[model samples]
Target: MKIFEMLIPMTWEGLKVTMSVFAITLIVSLPLAIFVALLKGSKNKYIYKFTSAYIYVMRGTPLLLQLMFIFFGFHYIPVIGYAFTRYQAIYIAFILNYTAYFTEIIRGGINTIDIGQFEATKVLGMSKSFAFTRIILPQVMKNIIPSLGNEIITLVKDTSLVYILGVTDILKAAKSVSNTYSTFTPYIFVAFVYLGIIAIMTNILSSIESKFDYYR
Candidate 1:
């Protein structure tokens, strides 16, 4: 309680920034992942290859590097330079990084489905897209929920990475308080705040997972 009294005012603005990054990344990346996953299976070689390369670049590289390259490095290039604002760059970088990961996760879920189902759809003379979108995608959503929850948990901490861009997130806010007070109290406060967030998130995810349990 004393810690909150000391830190909450100073850190409120930073918390807002952190939550915004997490929310936007999750909102945009989840749906975009489904689309990208479909493209990864596209019959057109070019589309499939392009998606593979994009995912490779995004997941193969450090997310911090992705943030730096977008916000700082891209500014040196013509046309692309000066295109996105700092805020936009932050969202874009986070979204792209998470989308690649989610895409692969979804693809993994898709692969876990039995091939016999695909054969069933073919035997029924149903189109591949229909079966995929209707019969397959929902089950994939259920299968991937736990995986997605794990990623979301990671994203909460990963939001701290934005401090590297001088975004004044909670970590940055804590650093300022720490410097001014010449104490580690601020970091302690920040850690508690993060734990509180993760605690709530864990509860919500458990509830979500339980809702799908009957299907199993």
Candidate 2:
């Protein structure tokens, strides 16, 4: 078979895996990020300590090691061993990793809101929680959209890391196709697929930024 023929099929297969992981990560991470950001910003000492340690551990570790730990390490445990599949393990690892990163981003957005705004909301008879939801978070969302978009684009490329757990993601698909055909054209095809997805993401993010331009 010609190299281009092998490239197309390989690229298609890999793109599926990459998109699946990327989608799942974004869905799971967004809410988790808000929760963690709140915890990290809380005044309670225990909450601060626990969330700080969690973020440190996640950020400090290599993502590949984290995936391997989740995929392989849990099997040695008592009951959960038989329950986790490679796909589930990979999903958990990606979600947790991205959640930590996004939490920091979100916390930055929250911090950018002035304390004066919160005080003014309180003076206006708004409860703290109500003020956060109605007044503060909306503006934070505007600030965060661009940074979050960057993370989403990065996730598209990082999905290739799933191959560490034997997941057949796009880069792995390219490798398989290359090995089958004994050529490098499969990688070129895979790169094009990545470029196309990233291009689409850029357009979507740019649209979002324009829509939220009042914050700027």
Candidate 3:
């Protein structure tokens, strides 16, 4: 087989890892974001204070630092004793980082709904939770889709950071292939892989936006 044909399976394998991270991040982060948004929006001072500090620490620090800290830092802990593997560490790090960002986006989305809407919901005998599900969340998601698209694209590229913990994702696969072939072809192919993933995501998000435009 030609070198390009050989690259097909390796590149496909790497792409799977990258997509897995993206899927896991979204699945875990979306609901966590809603809870975090509620915490930040709560009337209780302690709840708000705790969430504020949590967001502050998460946003103020670098994701790479957080990842390294958990991945390697856990190894030094007396109890856990290196039970977590690199892929697990990377997944956890990305999930935490994405959840924080998603919370902010959701908060903004929720705020975009006019207070009059809530008042109207109350007048119509809707409970806060019911109104949020029936009216608020739909509108919030519409507003947040653009931001979500950006975050998802960033996640695609950010999976490369997994290499720091020795996870052989698409970018790392490219490196391995490059080292073996002594050429830049592998890296070029990996770029296309990333590009393809982003392009497909962009199209999917764009379609969602278009479908939701009627609600705007």
lDDT of each: 0.89, 0.87, 0.87
Query: Compared with the true structure, what per-residue lDDT tens digits does model 1 show for residues 19-63?
Result: 999999999999999999989988999999999999999999999
Better by TM-score, candidate 3 or 1: 3
Query: Can you give the TM-score per candidate against the true fold?
Result: 0.91, 0.92, 0.93
Backbone clash pairs in model 3 (N, Cα, C under 3 Å; residues 3+ apart or in different chains), count: 0
How well is each residue in 125-144 modelled by candidate 2, as lDDT tens digits?
99878888788877898999
Instruction: Evaluate residue 68 in candidate 3 and report its C-alpha lDDT on the 0 to 100 scale.
Output: 94
Candidate 3, residue 202: how far the Cα is off, in Å: 0.6
Off by over 4 Å in 1: 1-6, 121-130
Cα displacement (Å) at residue 15, model 2:
1.6
Off by over 4 Å in 2: 78-83
Candidate 3 lDDT tens digits, 65-162: 98899888988999877757778888888898989899999999989989999999999999989999888898899999999889888988988888
| TM-score leaderboard ranking | 3, 2, 1
Better of 1 and 3 by lDDT: 1
